[model samples]
Target chain A: MQDALHAALLPQGLHDLLPPDAGHEAVIVERALASITAHGYERVKPPLVEYEAGLLAGVGAADRDRIFRLLDPVTQRTMAVRADLTPQIARIAAVRLAHAPRPLRLAYTGEVLRVVGDQLRPERQFRQVGCELIGSLEPTADAEIIALAAETALGIGITGLTVDLALPTLVPALLEAHGITGAARAELETALDRRDASVLAARGDEVGRMLADLVNLAGPVDSALKQFASLALPASAEPDRARLFAVVAQLRGRVPAVPLTIDPVERRGFEFQTGLSFTLFARGVRGELGRGGRYRVAASNEPAVGVTLFSDSLLRALPPPARTLRVFVPVGGDAAKLREQGWITVAALGPVDDARAEAKRLGCTHVWIDAAVSEIA
Target chain B: MTPPPNLARGDLIVLAVPKGRILDELRPLLRAVGIEPEAAFDDDESRQLRFKTNLPSLEIIRVRSFDVATFVAFGAAQLGVAGNDVLMEFDYGDLYAPLDLGIGACRLSVAEPSDLSQSDDPSRWSHVRVATKYPNITRKHFAARGVTAECVKLNGAIELAPSLGLCQRIVDLVSSGRTLKDNNMVEVERIADVTSRLIVNRTALKTRPEEIGGWVERFREATARNA
Candidate 1:
């Protein structure tokens, strides 16, 4: 009994997806990928594991700690289980399809494994579905990715969705402009990451005042933009800010219905993002549904932007899917014919005295009786 | 954990507050922010966990200090008042401490018996045993300076550990010198300054910016007035 109990226990931050939820997650992933692929983003399937150096070359370097390492038996070299699919997509765009097109559009959906999980996202292994547009530096590319992410989420029934825009590099540029480095920079980084206002209150310098204003300036796009326009940024960061302004304007024109907010200092997950980035949120959802932003392809200079949605979080945002009508078909009944009419047929193994009782026992909503469908009730 | 049923009401907001000592300081701030909970909220003996405020859309829940970060971080409660000590211990990424209320002034410090500190040199020590509620912060503080800390967890009355020989040292919050003196202990090193902050859930601020940002602005004004 002790051995049996031990066998039932899985590793922490991992679990088996049982029954309807498992099926529901697959359907959602398909719907999401379909919506993304509809925009001519041809799908690509990357392996679950790859050579460590190849996997962790560029943008993937940030995720080195999270990737699970294993020694390949053949080459005796280290292999890493992919912690994020964006890097794998980047590798493909650089090496496999390097000469394909200027703006290569690729879509992928696969399970990713991590060494551990954070408190906000506790699933060490979960599916990521996303599309990346490579070899494009245009603000329109950023706008397209944002619009596609919103469209995919909206199409899948995530209500009251919000797309929060952030420029992760903006704050660092501001700090660098003021010669803030070493311990002081680290302190300010932590303060900004936690969105703490006390740091601003304590530091009364010109930079401090500017950062505080920016923190308060974070809000709805219209008002925040109005306030942001008056704030002056260093010349070195002007291009990034200009790109953001362009993307925001383009996004407003394209997907105006989706709510947009900007936080110039949000630098949590976009460690490698060089330009505009956005995180997707649905009202009342526990965490982010997905996030995407601009970056360079691994081992190459090709500019890219993509959005990766968490299937688990997306499931949380959506309502429990409508139950499929399962009709109990008698042993001799035509199961295939009933299935064609959109009824999930659960056939009887043997003849039953009462079809209604049998249907109720098998969790079916309907029963095939007298050559017609009848409600279980 | 399942969120509270009222969380589904987009118009309503929940503010989780620490139940004990900080409540006195928070009261005036709450009043300044135009929030008045029912009179029962002030009753120590009242077995209420939640109370309706003067604001029709806002409610307040009183919980343990540590749980305030937990509540707000999980989006179970959209807003909370938590100390920086608790915030540093948990270091929850979901919580954004946008305003420093500047209340609950204290310091998380390493404390040992008065006699031990007389001969003890913190820089010379390689390893030490401690008793405290904040093991994470204690371990981090010691590890930063090449000291390996073995912390024995104690929720309350941490000062009693040294006398009982459970541990020779402790890492706990020091508000005044009275408690350490009463327990025959002295502060060795201070880890971080402690103060309560106005924390908002990241997702809450993102999804309901207008409503949540409004509260943050109001709190900012209230704190500025106090300062």
Candidate 2:
């Protein structure tokens, strides 16, 4: 019964990050945070839990059904374990740092718990480290965020990184301005999402051809833009197209080696994004390294661009982390010197009979013997 | 016994494809996409689970229809062909379905025995007990209508549920009315239209865009030919 009680059983979608992976995840978080901070991003720590309504107010409203809520005994108000940190960051930018300078750069790193794990990410809890530029709408700002994300991945030795840029509202804005609304707009959105040009053709011919022209404009940025260069667009959507083009152009100059793709119709995960949104992926990795784009601060109309890297996936994609060399030290010996020599000292509490055996038992790779550290045999 | 070869990270690209009925239509699509798997891949009698393809670094993994989504989502396999039904049921944020393969056409439906349908008004029901493979989708569907759906999660044999008193109604995939009639049940509502999709991990698509995107275009061409 005791053994059974001590069993490492855990709920589905939850896991214990044993040994090196746990330490590796922390290292990745630190390294990514360091990369973002180099660009003048100050770090902020949000509470792991917050008032449900406040946390779900703006960009986070999309994660409505996924938050875990509990009643607070003191205030009698419902409290929520945060499922996402972007909304919390937005709230901070809008309220707490309301008086801060323009383009408020804030970085954060922490764990989030979700009610159910998505298919790719089966962990109910995972770490998210991100930087949010809270007050700029320029295409240059978008380029900077993308470049910073690329730099973070590059810092960790991820090469062949590709950025998929999307103008979520561009197509919808164009269709609406061109008299596609209500059921028609929804149908067209579905058609574009599925790449089903037939549905567009069956419903309305003129709109169908226009959508075909737009949806076909997805590929390498240069070719895609050249296609968009000739096509007529709705008058109102001109700025959106222009901004996306400008962002792409600026991003090209900054990260010359990174490949870029443009897909104008993808809005599945970018519900709250106002203008441009981008997702980052690299060769051979299975999930997105990070993704972010444009959004407004909680109460302000100002634009913001940010990216959040998934620590778990990043660690998985990275090579095995370097283990700290640990040496077993005898009691009343030069433990401080071992520390100064760069060995992680595991000191014995008392005088030991066999330093080698003690080192082996304690899982230490080395032992202090006769004033010198030697490999345990 | 030796375990299957472990693919070193970035050394190879894996494609997860469904093993059974769907493969009948999928083989031609694979051909159109110019992917020719080894002879052992098509052998139902073969115990081997993974097979090498004509391309040096690409391979095929045969698995259950639902598992295709999981494997691709987790990055065990970077690409997969899965039905939207499985996609909706799992909802993996990391799995991005770029193209609808236009194969495996079907619909998910709610069904009940014919006798129960005459006197029972589903609209007036406050609560329902349903046996289904898709409990999440079942609950969400009924919840949207202000009805409580208590779903008993089951793996297959949904046709026998009503007779066995497992539940009054069952939600299952309907390829035709034959299964419903044979079970003394009738289709009452459609949950969603189903179709196979070419899904890729969002990260995989970005990191290896040239290779992944090339396959996407090939599959798109194949799908276009099929259409």
Candidate 3:
């Protein structure tokens, strides 16, 4: 039988990002930040751990289960390791930059640890690079964040990328407008999320018909909107429909090259989404590269839209970074000089007979001997 | 992914299915979908984790019920059969449940020993301790009713907990309620009805809509015919 240590091994869903891949993820994140930074987004650094109350406040309240809680040794109060940086960034925007200025453009890169990993993301720990455009409730701001996400993926050299835009509140507004409230409303919403027509039809004739029509309204952006335009939407929901159209129009005008699809009533993972939201994906990639949408700050009376790129999956979609020639130099050699020569330099810590073999074993392609470099044979 | 010696071709699409009873129920659906697995796939004695299907582009993997969502969500597998019970517990944003396969029907419920349940009033309880496979669902259910639930997460054999003093109640999946009855337990509150769904990676559907949509349609038709 295995020992207790073996039983204790790998609490599941935890993973280590190693070597070239780890560095590649970092580089991709940096380039993505640069792309967003070009759009006037300044960087922010939030603490890795915070008071559970602060972290769980407002829009972040739903993530209570995802957080890893620990008792603070000094204060004896509950603390939480951030499972998501978006909420913390939202908190930062509301408090730290509360008085900074109107329309705060903030970017952040940090590691988040989750209590458990999901189907598409099985890593408990991963890096996130994201940007938020605050203080804007405009359709242009929503469109800008979407364009920025697509462009950022492009900036990281990812091609054939697609951005799926979803309006989280559309259905709620529709259901409320149609007088489907409380339990019935939630049940109807679940039916929509699952695309289960049977459950939807069981609700009632009129409600079922409207929801089924709404489900059919999801497809390519142009076609879905055309369908939405034809429908006689309620007066209360007209504004939401109008804003969605405007956001789509802005995206079409700004970045026509990036293919955009519409999922009008998708509410999953958009718990904090207030208006237009989007998810980023690339051709041949398994998971979402990034996701962002419009949301209201929990305490601060400001509107915000942000996009967070998951480096774990983003790097997977991206082509492998061009390998830099790695050269090994014997101890006492000028390793720094080789670095300036545009090669990754490794230094031998101990003496070795076969310099070539040592260099290859160390993952270096070249070895230096007597101030001369030669490819490992 | 590299193909094993047993597989004839390259790794194409991986479909994750929960092992045991669900797999048994899914056999007819798989055959209806026009895919046939190698003979070893049905061999209970075989210890293989993955099996080759007649369609070279498609493969099958058997894992824990909870893991189907993870595999598909991560894109390690493009398609999966996952219960909404697992889906609700994990709440994977990356997964898209396009269809309810209408198989593996059950309900997630709150249960207690037959004796305790007779005297128990779930509505009057301010705080409750429970054993459950779904802590998130349990907590959310209790929280919705203005009750705080302290949950002890267990993998299986939850009915034994109530009698052994692990907890007076358990939140678990109830199919025919046979296990609960055998253990002298009774279900008090049902959280949600459960069923298997055709879960696909959200990105996979968007990237290769034709291929993924085709499979989704086949599964949908097969389910409809069976139903």
lDDT of 1 by residue, A20-134 (tens): 8899999999999999999999999999999999888777887888999999999999999999999999999999998897799999999999999999779899999999999
Best by lDDT: 1
lDDT of 3 by residue, A1-377 (tens): 95668654676777666787878877888788889899899988999999999888766776888999999999999999998788888888898788988788999999998888875567888888999888998888888888888888887888768888787877777777777787877777767766666677666677687677677566567777898888776676777788889988988888889877777777787876788788887866776788888888887858888889888888777778787678899987898988888777898888889888888898887889888888876
lDDT by residue for model 3 (B1-227), tens? 56655555313778999988888899999999998998998999999999888887888998998999989887778899999999899877667787888899999998888898777766798999999999999999999889999999999998899888988989999999999999999888889999999998777766665577679889989999999
Model 3 chain A: lowest-lDDT 10 consecutive positions: A2-11
lDDT score, candidate 3: 0.83
Which TM-score value belongs to model 1? Answer: 0.97
Q: Which interface RMSD values do the candidates have, in the order shown?
A: 1.0, 3.2, 3.0
lDDT of 3 at B20: 84
lDDT by residue (tens digit), candidate 1, B1-227: 23346556566799999988999999999999899998999999999898987776788999999999999999989999999999999999999999899899999998899999888877788999999999999899889889899999989999999999999999999988799999899998888999999999999999999999989989989999998
In angstroms, give how far residue A23 of model 2 lies from its true place: 3.1
Models 1 onward score TM values of 0.97, 0.85, 0.74
Candidate 3 Cα deviation (angstroms), residue A355: 4.3
DockQ of each: 0.83, 0.41, 0.31
Candidate 3 is graded, for docking, as acceptable
Q: Judged by DockQ, which candidate is best? A: 1
Clash pairs for candidate 2: A119-B92, A282-B207, A283-B207
